[model samples]
Target: MRLWVCIALLSTVLCASAERPRIVQGMIRAGQFVRDAAGGTRDMYRAYKDMREANYRGADKYFHARGNYDAARRGPGGAWAARVISDARENWQSRVSGRGAEDTRADQEANRWGRSGGDPNRYRPRGLPSKYYTRDDLHLLWLCRSAVAWPGTMRLWVCIALLSTVLCASAERPRIVQGMIRAGQFVRDAAGGTRDMYRAYKDMREANYRGADKYFHARGNYDAARRGPGGAWAARVISDARENWQSRVSGRGAEDTRADQEANRWGRSGGDPNRYRPRGLPSKY
Candidate 1:
């Protein structure tokens, strides 16, 4: 009898928790949640989100290029949404690494971030544009998450922040951005992926080819896409962009340099003007 009663109580408790819905869309109204503790009210997530959005709005303008970036990329924020989920996962691991996947505090934080569109269902309960966040937005989420979660503690989070900085710096290297641009160019040229032509013939067949010819993926898929449909145009564009990109990417400039280029910035030949040396002539020795 006691066991049955206990099970019933547990189910009721879980159902109650599940019932408390969260819909933090635009502005935050901190009155109700800040008060009703038993109602599962907690403004911490809202606080974290607000702080994160403020930072991402600015970062989205600078770090992410317009007209190309997907709204919901993947990983935490996307494949590169490291700034938001890494530290929390790490810190959660640091605090409770050995525990099972069902660990309490870890599950709590996971639920919080997940509700904010962090994982498999990142698009399901979507609130804002995933492209809305740049690399810096990830940092903002990490920082804000840490702040609201820990409030006054700086020691543990400081180390976390530093680690995040290092990882982000490595991942968001200028090279990555440049590389993506080159890849985009490659896709454009090789596939003959003209903006107009793509849109024009897009529905000519009407066999659900909306993004059929569109390409931009990771290594293998991207390369594979380069062989699909308009991949010829993409390849050509990539090839052209690469001609210039290859010069710097290969580090060959440093390996082999001509004397003329270094001397006087190539304004004039080192040969004496009075010597009257021509392109194919020997001057007076």
Candidate 2:
């Protein structure tokens, strides 16, 4: 009986010893999680504060993306914190701030993009002070250095096309172009996109085909958005205006109007338009 008792005590001691490391590891992990989550919250606040201080127009989306990206980089805990904070902020803005659903949706999209590790520079506005960015950010724009020598509209198109491609791809080199309209060529690209929208409208009017309306809507938006940020801006403006007008004046039901808007958004976001192309639609469009 004495030997059995000793053996039992020894077994209990061995079990406790074996469990100690696991308990210690779990505690360490829990502490790290709390710290990372706290860091993430700080990251979000810092981004928001920097954006307010920067006070640059059209840069809100960029900041939103940047903040989420910074937070998510910390690890799983950081990502969870970011999502919670972002969702709460968005909910408050949408409900209390009276922001439109579309605006709120766009903000969330930017948030998701950042948290997904996408480059926040995708939404960076032109002429935002270089000081707001790191050396790495500036280096990204430097990829277009090759376009500096090109002249005329040719330069603008070449650089913008290259910019769009590089912006979409992993990385590539492109030269700078001269005679480019200022405002980061935003004005020119927007004008071109507007023209595309107008041309699409004119063509649709001339065709007057009943069933092919959706096709024209998508085509116009796709072409406009293909022009770049300016084009995308123009397309969005036109699409919203047209949808609102039709919903109020054309007597189209809300559902139909929403469907039209969906197609418009789809094209603007670079979705293939042929998906909306109706059977027997002319090849010309």
Candidate 3:
């Protein structure tokens, strides 16, 4: 249920801006550096993992000290020490699915307790229902042409990026014009690739393997864009960004720094206040 709710919110945002369209990637790269900085949107999962490790280490040290001190005593004269150790072990085990052997026994007991209809994959998230997002809903071709122009909605802005390749070729004012063109190409290619990825997600949700394979073209195109005209910079920044954002709602700060450096080298600031945006990238998401 929590997973479904999360997916629903993400899908709704994607769908909601399907018609209005905005250049979310470009805007973020160009102006939202400070915003991404504020919330730690990038590497948030890494931070959480670090916190979890710290908590576990602290608990382990405390419990190990307690058990070692108590378990050292022996004989009937040390019965009180033995009881302390046993109770401490049980309490610690119960707190964390039981510790080692105790936990293994508890699992076996639970398995037997629910043998009639126990689920082995209860931890696995259930796939979305077949009709989750009809073929029409996730299909980028059928989505609104101007859908991705805002600060937050990525769909419509992505759709518009499909048209940027043509203009990028003629954008020569910037001395490092090649970088801008390459960046534009990355935006276009990454967007189209992302749309197909979304479609694949939809297909998988419906158990539509054959349908999912249809996005194979997108995968190939994405590979080419990343490996060819789009180049290494694109791979490190653009594609990685879309991938990170979709999967983790995050971005890479290191890549952002690289982009800023590249843009600065080309006489354009990634954090420029009055960035010249096409109609696609408005002030909001």
Task: Show model 3 residue runs off by greater than 4 Å.
Answer: 1-148, 152-174, 208-285
The clash count of every prediction, one per candidate, is 25, 7, 15
How many pairs of residues collide in model 1? 25
Off by more than 4 A, model 2: 1-20, 134-285
- Residues 1-285 of candidate 1 have per-residue lDDT tens digits of 989856744543333221123322111123222223212211223324433664633232122221012222221123133223334554576567676654434444444443343322222222333433433334444544544545466646644543443333321345554444344334333434343233323332343323221211111123323343445344334434533564678665632223212221211221111121123211111
Query: How would you encode candidate 3's per-residue C-alpha lDDT over 1-285 as one tens digit per residue?
Result: 989856744553443221323454443333333333332222222223333444543223222222222222112222233334445545666688636775545433333322222221221123312222111122323333545444565765555543332222221223353344345545444555445444434543554333222122223223333333333334335434544564454344655445433432221111221231223222232
Overall lDDT per candidate, in order of appearance: 0.33, 0.73, 0.35
lDDT of 2 by residue, 1-285 (tens): 989856644553343221234544455456567777998898888879879999988889988887888888777777889899999999999998887899999999999998897767777887776456522233335535645676888768766754554343211112332123223456556878999999989988987777767777887999999777889999999989999999899998899998888889888998756567666555566
Worst 10 residues of 3 by lDDT: 128-137
Rank candidates by lDDT, best first.
Answer: 2, 3, 1
TM values, all candidates: 0.17, 0.42, 0.21
RMSD of each: 27.4, 21.8, 24.5
Of the candidates shown, which would achieve the greatest lDDT relative to the real structure? 2
Error of 2 at 264 (Å): 56
User: In candidate 1, what residue range of length 10 has the lowest lDDT sum?
Assistant: 212-221
Winner by TM-score between candidate 3 and candidate 1? 3
